[model samples]
Target: MGRPRVRFTGRTEADAEAVLAAAAAHDACLSGAPADWEIPAGCAA
Candidate 1:
């Protein structure tokens, strides 16, 4: 089985930071991460 997925969407830079930090704090790996994770981008897979 694969790791369960978590979705993250960021309209602004701060939103992105909060999502990344929350994932890290939970020791969750952010799969398919982009070079810049804190851009105005949303990630899910």
Candidate 2:
């Protein structure tokens, strides 16, 4: 199977940051392999 694809729309920069932060926290709680969650290079936040 292929990786999941998600697109966040109608959200401000802060909202996007919050989503990323939540994902990080969830990963920490699970203590599992970290997912590739990051802003793409050269993309303005």
Give the TM-score comparing model 1 with the true structure, all chains together. Answer: 0.38
Task: Name the runs in model 2 displaced over 4 angstroms.
Answer: 1-14, 31-45
Best by TM-score: 1
Model 2 TM-score? 0.36
Candidate 1: tens digits of C-alpha lDDT, residues 1-45: 554544654446746765676566434345434432433233332
lDDT tens readout by residue for model 2, 1-45: 433544445666757666676555445443332354444322224
Q: C-alpha displacement of 8 in model 1, angstroms? A: 1.7
Q: Give candidate 2's error at residue 10 in angstroms.
A: 8.4
For each candidate in turn, the TM-score is 0.38, 0.36
All models: lDDT?
A: 0.48, 0.48
